[model samples]
Target: MPKEKSLVKNVMYKSLLSLFNIVVPIIIGSYATKIIGKDGMGEVFYADTIYQYFLIFGAFGIYNYGLREISRIRDNKEKLKQLFSSLFILGVASNIIVLLAYAGFIFFNYKGTSSFSIFAIYLFSIFSNLFYVEWANEALEKYDFITIKTIIVKLIYIVALLTLVKTPEDYLIYAGLISVALFLNNIISFVFIVKDIGFTLKCLTFRRHVKYLIMALIMANGNVLYTQLDKLFLGSNLGKDTVAFYTTPQNVVYMINAFIMSVVYVTIPRLSNILAANDEKAYLKLLNKVAKSLSLFLFPAAMGLTVLAREIILLYAKPEFLPAVPVLQIFTIYMITLAFESILSNQVMYVKKREKVLICFIICCGLFNLIAKIGLTKAGLLTPVTAVMTTVMANIILISLEFFYSTRVLKVDIPIFKLDKFKYLFISLLFIPITYGVKMIFASTVMITLVTMILCGSVYFGILLVTKDEVVIAILNKFLKRA
Candidate 1:
């Protein structure tokens, strides 16, 4: 039954969600950036990062653990109910501790800053995760439900951002709008979850879930360092302007990476079930499909970013963020590394209970990033651009170690990287010179970026179309045949 849950259909719905996630952020952020200016954007994200630390503690890796565990036992209603209740209790307990700690930090350390009050308000997000049953829906492969609900919330968020955040001083209003959307999204998802499974607190056991919870916490901690800590370090050392410059480009890359990873994420629960069933043939087949899918999407996505980095930044934020070009370019590599890392880590390593190995690798990278970021900042070497470079290097190392573990140590003995990947890479690379030529011929600007993206993207796919690239062809046939 789990295998029968169409991966293609899940990917389609998740892609819709990903598209909304990407486009809405860019559109709202472009407006928000212009309205709030760099300093205002910086203040919001800075406070938001502080809140993220609390969020990490509150979430306690329960989402991932819950998805994996629940998917494994999804057919058994009683077990699924008990697991959900236990995870819920664990999440609630953690959120309380995180909330108090957050309040104390804000009062003691950040009380004087303009963003402190905003950060205080944003602290309510700690409980949002408890109301968000995304992990359960994901485990149950409820993409249609998740996608529709998320689209509605994001559409409302876009309208709210457009209407409420009209001026520079509306920064807190902007933050509030975002917070409201976050809470509303989680609460709505929770409502749908209740409709599906109903509410039950009976027969919950925290002790049984404790081992995975601790492991999840460690994984979440290691991950938070690179993702959220980058902004904090940038803000502390270089101020809000630098945070804006670095985060602006980083946001584009993050959205692109998020889109690609959506499919990988949608597959993880299925992979967990397949692994549990010990169906190596099906497991390896799934792995190859994921690899090809990443190649098909990531190559053009990452390469195009590198090619049009300047146009993208200027169009996405404004000329004020022109300094983020190099940051965006360097982050393209990070996007690629992170894509493979998620597939290997979640689909292979995490499924095999290789959390210890992942934990060790992730911690080393996190520590390295911490030391490098702080050291570079203190040494006056880590500008927003250089700081991004540092983050990319850390990601490269992290993925390298994980890839080694997946292939050598675990010896999963499946072709994680297929030859077809080179075809995609080569085809994606072909867009660079053509796009660059267009830019040189027609002076670079927002128009040039849009045209080049359209022209080059069409050509890139044209070649793939001609060659009948299996991934491209498969996807096209699937959609076009239905049409």
Candidate 2:
């Protein structure tokens, strides 16, 4: 495949899979909610989210760092092995550390967390999630193998989940069983990827690789914390069903965010390579192109979702989840902020100056989120809405801080909140009429949704073209020229 096509493959396949990752969890969670009742469902979800918080530790930044490093050194088998082995060792240690920490949190109740046994099962899920590292193959631009593996694993997960999960009576057992399936999936994925990629991971010393692992550990925790900590806090302070209520909106917004980040993640290795070669002009050009391209899609999508979040949420989920519609709206706004922040974060990390700044930023954001959420919840605010608002505000703060730092590092005025964003802003506002019309049409929800989605995209793209927005035109020219 040609370069652009190859890049598109990674972004698109992962985009599709990310959708499953988001949708499937919600389906399973919702199913459990029906069978187990809101309270029981919330307890299981709480365990899962809590486990995920520690899963951040096992991840330890390898998703970004490993992909970049492995791509750069793909030709050197020994070095690749060394890097892989070191990251693997660090991941294992991190998982153990997290498990031990879970024990402590369990013993102390960490402000009334759930039981140690439940957390322990969740610990199993964290280990299984590490198989996501096998995505290093996808990052290496080996799509077919990873896609195939993902299909198998995802199918197994869906099948296992469907078969084992039935009633509220066995909710926790079902949850733990699902975790076992995930571990099996990961193990199988690792086996297939090592075979397909043909890399040997041999004896590696932690002493030599400790520095990279430490930086990676810090970066990984910061990244995951920014995304998942709110859910954890909400589950702990507010309630688990509240966690479920928040999940719908967060997942929807996160789906869009995942797609945007997927595109950026796929390009990072290429970006890093260009930077390594000191191709200054090319780096800036690529960054500008990516930022503009990402904004064109992300901005309008987020804004439109913010506009019609109610319709989308109520349409997909049952009536019980109707409360999340407003929460989804609030979270969609954060997705917008995150859209901008992602571009800057990638640029900063590409320069190797991101770790410290990003860590500090996540800490501030998490603290702000915690404080705000506590106040809002205490003030009789609903957990879903309060958590969503708190998170959006946190993201906005992070964006401002990042924009300040990005300008210095890139030596260019990098407003992640791009100017052409107004085009999206304007077009998004037009969705109000479409939404109102859809409400009055008296059509089946299916037909209404299909038509509204079409209208929204049509109007958004038409407005962008008519305005001759630079980002749209540039992307059009690039994509069209290849066509």
User: Which residues of candidate 2, in runs, are more than 4 Å off?
Assistant: 1-5, 19-37, 100-120, 129-132, 196-205, 223-227, 377-382, 413-415, 464-483
TM-score of 1: 0.96
True-structure Cα RMSD, model 1: 1.6
lDDT of 2 by residue, 353-396 (tens): 46667767767876887677667767877367766776778888
- TM-score per prediction, in order, is 0.96, 0.85
Q: Pick the candidate with the highest lDDT.
A: 1
| Per-candidate clashes, comma-separated | 0, 0
| lDDT tens readout by residue for model 1, 1-483 | 455788899998998899889998888888899889888888887787778777887888898899899889888878887888788778888888888888888999878977677987777676576686789899999999889998998888888888788888999998888878889989998888767766677877988788888887787576576867778877877787888887888889989888888878998999888888888889888888888887888988999999888888877887888988988998898888888777777888888898887898888998898899889877879787777677778888988888887788887754546676867788787777888778778885866887888887898889988988888888889989889
**What is candidate 2's local distance difference test score?**
0.68
